[model samples]
Target: MPQDDKISPRKPRRAWPVAMAVVAVVAVVAGAVTWRGQADDGAPSPDHPRNRGTELVIAVGDVAGGEFDPLKGWGSRPAQIRLIHSSLLTVDKNIDFVGDLASDYSVSDDALTWSFTLRDNARWSNGEPVTAQDVIFTYDTLKKDGTRFDLTFLDRMEARDDSRVDFHLKEPRSTFVSQLSDIPILPAKHYGTDYSANPIGSGPYVVADYQVGQQLILEANPHWYGQRPQFTKLTFLVLGEDAALAAARAGTVDIAYAPPAFAGQRIDGMTLQSFETVDSRALTLPTLPAGGKGKIRTNDVSVGNDVTADPAIRKALNIGLDRDQIAQIVLQGHGRPAYSLVDGLPWFNDQVVFEDGRTEDAKRVLADAGWSDSDGDGTVEKDGRKAEFTLLYPSDDQLRSDLALAVAEQARALGITITTKGSTWDGIYLDGKANAVTWGGGRHHPHQIYEMYSSKVIDSGYNNMPQYTNTTVDGYLDQALSATTQDKANEFWKQAQWDGQTGFAGENGDTPIIWLLRLDHLYFVRDGLNLGDQPIQGHGHEWALFNTLVQWHWTS
Candidate 1:
């Protein structure tokens, strides 16, 4: 939903390798390791020790291929890439961007040019000094080869000296620095077409051994400039959910990701850790017809249901639902009620709150818009057209299915008829055929709002799924991107939500999307393992659990 997992090349999402389908199910090993001195009731102990381990075993859903090519081998293997390579910038536990290979960076007055100075002592795993040339080579290679990331905004890249590199941009972009946090710098001299197989990097850890479809072993990098990892070895075992849970129960794995369904289940010596996420589940509303206003588009399409095209109908749907009940019943209390696309994030605007279950207000808005229950009929109708639309949800997602049913029931109480139906991702979202569908998304940066709601992204093939178009929304998003400082940019983002005239919550405006709740990520950790502070997660990947690997330790 963050556009990072979509397979389309034109879209902002990352493309997974075709081999992922073959490795979805892996065999579980027999005879898991058993440990003694288990905690009572498996609850975390208050007197647990710290920094007492030389090795750790973590169970993951999948294994990364031996390939370590930063340009070609990412998305599908984020954990491996992050451990083996170092980016110019990195985000801390607070989600704040900081330098990794770079010592400092500066932006020009017009925001069109940025310059970064490399840390003098930064060296690759092979003990070669990381220079500005490596940074330039990485950027130039990505631009020339057309990597998954969109770097078209860059005009040119130049290295002023061995320690400095400058980037000139075609347009001002406030989030450019944040985006650079994921692009790892590679050693240009050692890089080849097959470099992914034996990659060298400047990160704190290096790949020691790799066994395809089984496990990967990581060792501390002797030449790392930062604080060295305490653990001498880290082994990541490939396992499915059931297998991971089995391993955790038997004390074979030090850490494993757990879903909400495993909430009450307790292991003999493990602690369940829950962390907040920015990811949210919402419903998308169509604002325009499928076909162009006058001409035909690439593919033949039909105009969406006219009932949802009305702004009053969308507004009523937004304020008419009891989100708290949905969070309790649908999510089993694992999530919190969400009011906007970015409810828990720092940039989220608190002023645009929606009242719960305002059935009377919803009825008045629909009635004012020419809808009436004529002839004492329960359903509202105007000019022989009934207020009815079909709500679609993916057939396989239990959470979405439950939410759809709840929404339909609430809409019926307000004189609106909503028919719930099951649909596949391709059937409902590929061409935007369904009237309304449950949507998912969340991003670490506030630019996500511009990508999903701006009129400019309607034709971008990723977000703007409902074809929402507004000149005022586009202007505000542009201003947010061009702002000189982050504080000023945050104000512009808030304005895009509600500016008292033409925002998503303005008097005359109807929101194109309805938010429900933010899901929390759960994990099972062994009693002695101490994972450092973790930041709220975004939607794309699950590898963020090991972001603080350097700080992880075990107690006796």
Candidate 2:
């Protein structure tokens, strides 16, 4: 969900430190961020476009501690971790692997070994040259610590002198390449237990100070090897949604994470920036019977929901509800009506999409499946079993709760009784196993498909919450992971969802989850700041905000 919370490293992203002089940029900045600007105080207002302020202060929501650490799953999402540190490889918005710290890379004929050539000019913020040893150490630590990226296939890593590194794999796991973009490299000599608090890396900026519950201040790294940033100093103020909006209205900050609820608000020096994201909200229903025996990542966890386990009910729910209308109503028209987890992505099977709002169609499917409202009551039943279930959402999350409530409203029309409840995640896992729980799943990589639909990760952390299992889907996932080329893998990933015959999507076969809508990340940036072409943001809003942070500059 936005690694805004450490709920899953799910979107733990990157941020870089800056040390620009922002006094002329805005009227007021919080403590310790005083700046001596390049222009005089009496100069024409810097509020207009083309006024290149030396400093930038932003009011953001998710700058929690430990998120700055890459080894601990920080860079897994599209966050600021990439700003302070560089990975050997980086992923572009096109979902293609490009070089970051490493400039050139290739794989062996056997596909068991991958190698990279590091950039000669890259150096740490601490004035030390970044080396292959650092890359090796970073990956080694991630493997040992069990990070978000899968590295079990790693046999070992070797460095060829200072500028090159080679990764030896236990198998021809093609997914290993995707892992390179998910991690941020760390310097070997200085990395320690307290590294997250005091990090040293080779990104465009360096962490100057982070006052808990207050703000994070960053300064430009003199030793940075990339293009020089326009703003030298970066300040991140941690404020609640309303509080950040207030600060934005006051013109005290350059940018703020604008809540969709208040998306229509207008501010004098600020303009709204909407980013389409893979971050989505959906309902994962249990596919087995009540009290059924199943394992969740090697550990036994009860999994079942008799009512939801029915394919008819799932298929009905998939096509019955008008998700497009819901996206408009619930998301303030900022989100896309999501069908499959990866809708517009390359690997997604567009066949999963159906003309929603067909409540009569949903009823017809249910009636054919022997589910009918024979009773005087509005709810349907089959064999004396009522078609009823509870949908749970994290009590604190308003958006998910809204989605749950909205989805419940539509499902009820189909004669499927849906009762919505807001509860803690702990309580959901503890009791909602057999019940439908609203889930968050979206990312740039096709592996997100593997994680959600693949049998290999059914019970693994946060993936396959419905405990969905299909031999055909499993085989497709395995083939995707093993394919030597990305094109072949993409094909298999699509086939797993809907192979034109039988697959996971309800239209074709089974539907373990009622795919809902993807959230749109909205922000209020000061006028004149051009952020350039932004990538479609993924699960982490905070991490993905600055996908092209360096390219952001003032416009005339």
Candidate 3:
């Protein structure tokens, strides 16, 4: 790492005090506004004109697992993990797979063998040369207890030499290329149980300092083989949305990740940077009926919803609610209507889109299915069962809470009572199987769609919560994974979503889940801080915002 011409790469003078345990935005803002003294090291504050393009400070959402372990789901998204680690492959700005550490890559004609030729110059920050042994060790270690990549397709992996590696699969899968980008190559010599705390990698940056729950400082890695980043020093602060916004206002942070709720606000020296994303929220209604067989997860936790089990009730909710209106009210026009989890992706079937916001259409569908307000109680019923169910959202997530509340309100017009409540993520996981839960997830690939709808992995680590079962859908999903080419696979993936006559879509279609909106990730960025041509974000994970950090530069 460079020692000269770089901002202080040691401690962050304005580091949020973990000992004080202060979380209030007003308190932090007050302190930032009141303390106008120069740093003890005499380094200009990040907001100073002299340091406009030399350094950067970013505020991000919570750190998963509070550690940077690649095996424990740290480098799963296009995030900071990319800064400290190298992979055989990586995604470009458009979320397209491209070679990273590997100088060249190719797949076998059988579509089961994948090969990568590593670049010779790649070296760890410690000056150790990266080797094929390290790549094999990464996969072997992940196979034991990995929480990020789905290794179902990977049968075996081997290294041909220091600059060569190959992966053999049990089956053909188009997502295998994307999965390669998720696993960060680990150093075999320094890897162990304690590697998470003290890490070394072959990426563009070195971890200079890290304060648990407070801040992280990174300096440019001098041994990096890739393009040099313009800025040499970077600091990341973990703060709640309120405190992050306050920091941006106080000129203590260069960029602050915010939700649409704060998109209307303005900062003194910052510009609102809104990037479109495939990240969306969907109300997953369990397809299984209560008191039925296979209702229990592997852990014995019961899962299923009686009301949502009725396809007609699910379809009614999907047709009645106006998604455009939800985007207007809940997201404040920062988002748009979404039909399926893979909307805007190549495999998405736009034919599933239908006319929404029609109360009469919803009522007619319900009535044809034998649900009506016979007693005039403003609630539809059929065979003594009322059309109502509880909806759950993460208590801390304001976007999801707003979405759930809006959906509940819209469903009222169709006499379908929806009870909305905010709960913890753990609570939602256990209880969500029996109730409709507003969940958020979207990536560039179709694996998530298969996992959520496939019956083969029901209740297997939150996959297929609906326990939806359709032989045709399952066959399509299976064929998607087995398709030899990406284009062929996309066709099958689309068929799984909607085959015209029967599928997972709403509007007389099997509606196991009702997707509402695709949101835009809004950020408060310092003026003249150009984020280059950033790719459209598919995952909601805040870390993905740093995907184009290498392309950032200053205009003035």
Candidate 4:
């Protein structure tokens, strides 16, 4: 199971008081007045040069409803939160870490303490200096609230001065700096429980106006320390996929997040941009049985799943599927076949190779394992037990549905019975009785390996859905977490995948998961709108499309 930051979907909160309603209405009226002042030709008025070629409308799939507090807010609303706040560090289009609020940083020789120096010109939107105390406050608040991030290793955070802060960790973690990219620093004095209603940050944009379920208006922050944004004003229109497509076709929206299925459609004046992402669709094979009935035991829990428990069977299934055909038919050529869960990542093991479907090789492996079509019924049986299992996928996901059917057809040719069923995520995954399920996740840190395959989290329900356990795997992951340098840690991560003799794909190791394909994010941009180059996306939400929002410009 992949460790995802996605929060469960929640309904939009609607408890605007009378005073806030009045303020919202007045803001609308003022906006209307300003619109009326524009020239009839839709050009800026001579008296208002600030409004010249400075407005843009973007159509998103959904609206964020909850508070913007990083500690309490869900990961689903990253677009809104990212625009209104600033993180200590940020990732560029190339997925490299870069300084955002902090100008530079250094780590001690022991790799347990990190020190950062803030830029002299950095300030909040309110013209107040962004000091080290604000960072300390944000971290302390989140630590106290017990946020989702695993911060138990943190020992203390102290402000050495107004512009300098030091963080001490109990153990060395090569990926600690990358983790900071997800935590936004808030203004110590202005931020509170209700700060989402009126967020004030040091980002390039400031919320000028907001209407629940309608739209959000952003104005340039004059006190921002980075390069000035090209557009002086930006409006995010809240709309669904259909409405967003309609808006794009009607020339009402400057940019829209287009679904992959609709990416090739010819919109009048829009150009579709496709970005590669770490988002993947894969099948998780249970190493343990649905119920307690197997020989393997951990924490007094019995593990079953006799069919997949055999390393030979798991290896046969891994190489028995035609991933290229699945990528072409199911993904419609929008993605590439995946052999590893963390494909294209820096820590991925490039030496591990998976061959295409080989019916003869698959049969040979099963025969050596004592499975044969003894009854002439076209189904393999061993020890009076049939080689079959139930594979479940979310009923609402067509991609998973198609892949499930494709996998079932191929497995049947090898005398393995795979029954496909369409079920809800809760009915299968949450119930913890699913034999197999289609799963995916996105993360910048290699710790994701531990989240999915570590024995420590097998029963925690947060990850390790397969209940996979291997002493060697656990040792490699533990050493990686404590490794003093990234290069050294990266070698451990690669070895954990496959080290020629023992690994996930090793002859004696359990291949608990089978990767399929990587999903690509698609979007439609109105002609002449330069959105700059987009970076490779990780497996989070869709807010990554706005990463280059400040650099967007209109030529027409």
Candidate 5:
């Protein structure tokens, strides 16, 4: 679970918007015991690693870019969200959000007003009782003003009493309850205005100590009402890939987050667990920027003009990429090629497949659009101007840079000169004229489409980089959200997908962005690490590493 879709204000700038770019990262159902060759006699294998009593040390992929403010960077990044914090509702692997703090909850008849009953027995680490005021205060303090990394979902929240709370919505939102899973309930007494320095939480783990950019130390909360963690201390070491891998190989780190290049390698006395996700690597077309400091263009236009506003161009660009090749070759057959943003979900429509990357068809499509070669140069020209553009991506993400280079290579063949530029995550989307970048995440759900392409989200500085808008798509989205039956909602959702591809929701008629490949999200763990009875994490990280943490014991 990459935590790509959920937006939080206090999140690390590097991981925020970019975390969602990976394609094909999805939550997987737990494998059955029979499938793993468990003996019917109830005898365990002699060499099987099971329940080794020891401390668990994890090495995260990158350093924290911002403070450990759960309200800030920690809210958006799945790794941080799952380990360092726990929300009011905990979602299963199947993406069904179950109760965490609240013992039970029910929706109003109209689905407009929702009420929750807090667990009377729940208590914070500081021995303060968990009450309705904590929930209300958490929402008010973190969500009311909104943050750069936080998602904008709540309209207002009110506490009816110490044990009950009511959420009043502006309109009926089917996903409102599920969305509450994004906010981690904080103690009202601790986190008002002066809580940033001494943050307190009720999750299984609490922040023991934090170094600005080096590491965050989390100790298991002995007071947690749920099952106690086996490890006394969980250390999240933040470092670059090289340092992280080195630490993992040396056994200085227990869990490590690294790229595929690192996953392919083996370490002695450790284990590797390769898991798949529905996260797709993609390129976002930015709204063209007019002018800014140290930047000026001969023709000044709105940011949307940079790219994604043209249907034909976006379609041609999408059709040109050889997604299959990228999947099989570049990805080593880890993932499938994607046509739309919806990457991996059982409900995903299989009818759509665009594998023409680096093909003559894509070149022809662009050529027919009045872009052609001029002056005998390889690149295309339109109206005596070279069809040239620059794309910016994060240098830290190898897949993004590779995808950009691949697109640039194909663009050259099509007479469209696309230059590739790499920068830090913060700078990639800074001024918005960078053109495009690659992103990935878990499973393709309708919520992903709404979040990425919805016309209503542009102002939030999210995935609507192309500034695409369409009534037909919006209508489909509305029907999908309001429909009582999943079947009817799915029907409308499928129609929305079709309409989106037909230019109703995308950049004109063609997708403003070409979904290159559904990145087969992978993670490595030590040998004999069996996660028993895991949940299905549809499109988020709730199910992948965090949920299984409770059941995971050293089986060495």
Candidate 6:
């Protein structure tokens, strides 16, 4: 905490598990009982010893891969975005929408149009009042020229005046407000076609300097309409663990998002803060054909093979995974068991169970599907072809790589052979190819379904890597996206999960995507920093919660 810098530390009161402190310790012990904690009373306490600071430095395990532009790829990483942005609306832990830039908002009768009333007094760093034109301009820019990252729900945008703006939808979207929460309103005057390089916005912090792949320095924006940030200057230094750890351990940086493997190791005069997470590391097994020979896309077999098309195969693979062991051994209990796609979202239904780790069930499913161990070899074979494929994960992400290898071992026991491949993210996900490995999710919402499997993203296939395609599931997705009421929308959401589980598109009891674990985003801050109110939903890692930076403060 530096007074001259006037940076107040804000403690983000994220939920903690009973096993938080034990994760790294257990990983080191190599033999410890896994402890579980209830989420009922796990909010951050004001009197806790760890929460305090001003001008805190956080160690993030991974730096954003690209520039901090929504049009580019790095826009989705929540840690990088906090340096310069704010969303229009905020989602609380309970999945309620709160206004940010807008004072209030309302949906039309048909739910096809949503209007937001802007805060007339809100002003940009340049001392210009924030108007509806900024909103319209942002939407228009992304709609016409934005990259895939910035184009959600931006089919049409209209501005009536400085105080009001409307979003015309292609369909009645129940989660339109949540979707809008991802868009930050950039200044209309300063941000135009050249905005990506010289970005200007009415957010909590303004970019002071940018060094690609090196660092980004920021300064507080004085003209913000809400509570101003305490820190006058903030620096985001890009460095690897060896450097980040040296910075933190040497007291060069006060905070850092260190790796889970390095979690428990302590630096003199510094405390190690830990929290439970819903962020699970799992892989996508592509079920579609390769080389454009089948349904989804035309590409090499590098992304996925036609093997995932079998539902029984999906179920068998899922049932065989010992997620508890992975959580304990691979993740050191830093993660949770995941059975559904929305590991940390609001709509995550806890009723479903997939954790028997039953190899017999896996064997039964495969046997019924005509796969068997014929050549007297331990591995299952189908018509002289042994079940074997390569599982690919980001070369830089060790957690995912470990998970892939662990799952592969389990599949091996079931007479299935899975190999692991580490590759560059661009080659794996971008470049219009699919991979058998990738993991990501946000606050549980209907858009998770749309974004993951929707035809709109088949080209990039950012999250939906399985090359999974089905008309029945697509119909249910369209229903949920167009529902007029939240209750109706909820029904569609449930049905979608059921449809996925039922294997209605292909096999009744088979599924393509088998969820492995759930995650609660965890962040560690310097002592005395006030994180302010955080939404339990959406993991507060999305654009919706970036505004919390404005209200964070440091106390003596």
Candidate 5 lDDT over 65-165, as tens digits, reads 33545555455444345554556676666756578777888777766677888877677867678888888877777665564333354567777889899
Model 5 error, position 130 (Å): 1.1
lDDT computed for candidate 1: 0.71
Whose lDDT is higher: candidate 1's or candidate 3's?
A: 3
What's the residue-level lDDT of 82 in candidate 1? 64
lDDT for each candidate structure: 0.71, 0.77, 0.79, 0.71, 0.58, 0.59
lDDT of 1 by residue, 488-509 (tens): 8888888898886778652345
**Candidate no. 6 TM-score:** 0.81
Q: Write the per-residue lDDT of candidate 3 for residues 314-393, one digit (tens) a residue.
A: 88888888999999988898889988888868998988888888889889989999998999999999999999999999
Query: Which digits, one per residue and each the tens of the lDDT, describe model 6 over residues 1-556?
Result: 1123221122112223436423422221221121122232322222222223345444454443444456554445433454465567855545567787889899888887889998877887777888888888767766775454435554587778778998888778787765466666677778544555566666766666554444455677777677767766666655555456555544444455555555566665455554443444555666765444222233333444655655656777777777787666566656677776664354444445644688887799899988998887787777666677677777766566777778888888888888788888656654223346646555534566666665445545354566666666667777887798877877666666664554322223335566676644443345555656655424322233343566667756
* Model 5, runs deviating above 4 Å: 1-53, 63-70, 148-160, 287-302, 305-309, 344-351, 443-446, 478-489, 504-508, 531-544
What is the Cα-based TM-score of model 1? 0.78
Once all C-alphas are superposed, what RMSD does model 4 give against the true structure?
7.9
For model 3, the superposed segments whose C-alpha errors exceed 4 Å read 1-19, 23-28, 31-53, 78-80, 291-300
For residues 287-357, could you state the per-residue lDDT of candidate 2 as single tens digits? 88888766543456678888998989998998898988888777888987888888888888888887888
List TM-score per model, in order.
0.78, 0.86, 0.90, 0.80, 0.81, 0.81
- Per-residue lDDT for 1-556 in model 4, tens only? 0123111212224435667545433433233223223423432222221232678877754445445567654332333445666777877877777788889988898999989998889888899999999999988877776534566678899999999999999999877764577677889999876676677788888877665555667789999888787988877766656556666665556777775556667876678877888777777777865466322112233345777766666777877777888787777777888877787788888766667677888888899989999899998988898988878887755567878888888889888888888987656655333377677765656767877788876654347767788888888888888899888899898888887777774233467877778878777876787877777777633476767777777776
The residue ranges of model 4 lying beyond 4 angstroms of the native Cα positions read: 1-55, 59-67, 73-81, 206-222, 232-247, 250-252, 292-313, 370-398, 416-429, 459-461, 505-509
Off by over 4 Å in 1: 1-81, 144-147, 189-200, 206-223, 232-247, 250-252, 291-307, 344-346, 370-409, 415-435, 505-508
